[model samples]
Target: MNQFTHINASGEANMVDVSAKAETVREARAEAFVHMAAETLELIVSGQHHKGDVFATARIAGIQAAKKTWDLIPLCHPCYFEVEVQLEAIPAENKVRIESCCKLAGKTGVEMEALTAASVAALTIYDMCKAVQKDMVISQVRLLEKTGGKSGHFKVEA
Candidate 1:
């Protein structure tokens, strides 16, 4: 594993200094899964979520979350990014998968933003459906891959 850039030698939290790092096109993808009752999944697929359009709202919310990731996570650099998020309902099952891709040409990579987007999207799904299925759960928010940076590309163990 790479050295912990967000931690100091003293084992205290610290932000990485990227002023000397070169800027490049960096990108990352994240995924999240939400499981619920089979009937809830059908309602979402049928556009009957009552929250209007759950998938569409969640997609927009995820993009906004990526743009504001720095504000939410201390030590992360503020980033200008291009993000795309999709929420897909799994037919014949009680799950929805949220995928987010983020890109930036900057000294820091956008892994945090990607992960934040997917995480929030999954949460949004749960929020919209909770009234009906209080047991809906959001889980597995993770970075699937990252590319372009001094540390190089990564495909999470998969």
Candidate 2:
């Protein structure tokens, strides 16, 4: 069986030691989706929503969330990184898709950071549009791809 990196021999939870690991450029991409009513999406797309620019607000939230991933998630390492978040509205589907990419030159991977950014951005979208639609759902939050580290590159099959 594979050993858990965040667990000690005695089974106590602990942060992984990466002091000897090589510092290489690591990147990860994640995505999330927020489903809502067509009317709600229209409000956002037409810029008629009283809550203001949902995309701009959600983008900032994602970037901030990625930077603070270490503090938000236990056992995550603190590393400076760059994150780009994009939000797209699909009126035909009545949903918003959020994508986040995180990159850093560090010993540990930034998968968590990318995932966090997408998740938080989805939540922010829900928060901003809840007044008009309470049935919005945040779903499909997942890592699309990751590169670098000892495990090497991984990409989800489309």
Candidate 3:
């Protein structure tokens, strides 16, 4: 098995040194789900939420979060990348599905950025809708796929 990258021989936590790793096109995609009441979903979909433009606000928040992932996470390296965040409100499921994709040509992976984007996006949704629904649940924050670096390509089977 491969040893942990962030741990030195002395077992102290440290950032992985990707300096020697070749610069490759790295991309990562992540997803998050926010479950809420059907009424709350209707409020957002119908544009009747008092907060105003919930989707737009959440989208902006996600993008901002993706850009600052390196600063937020202690070990993440700051690298330029393109980020896309999409939010879908599923009425039948009474949930909002947020998906984020981050891509860049760098020595390190953008998985943390993608995951951060999705998670913060979900949180923004909850923050906007909390007035109406206090019990909203943010769940299933996960990495859906990643490509590039030594790991090559990965996609969740289920």
Per-residue error (Å), model 3, residue 111: 0.2
Q: How well is each residue in 1-158 modelled by candidate 1, as lDDT tens digits?
A: 67888999999999999999999999999999999999999888898777789999899899999999999999999979899998888876679999999998999999999999999898888888888899988888888999999978999895
TM-score of candidate 2 versus the correct structure, residues matched by position: 0.97
lDDT per residue for candidate 3 within 1-158, as digits (tens), equals 97988889999989888889999999999999999999999999999999999999999999999999989999899898999999999999999999999999989999999999999999999999998999999999999999999989999998
- Per-candidate Cα lDDT values, in order, are 0.91, 0.95, 0.95
Is 1 or 3 the stronger prediction by lDDT? 3
RMSD of every prediction? 1.2, 0.8, 0.7
Q: After superposition, which runs of candidate 2 have C-alpha atoms over 4 Å from their true positions?
A: none
- Residue 49's C-alpha lDDT in candidate 2? 91
lDDT of 1: 0.91
Candidate 1 has its poorest 10 consecutive residues by lDDT at 86-95
Q: For model 3, where is the 10-residue window of minimal lDDT?
A: 2-11
- Candidate 1 stretches with Cα past 4 Å from truth are none
Instruction: List candidate 3 stretches off by more than 4 Å.
Output: none
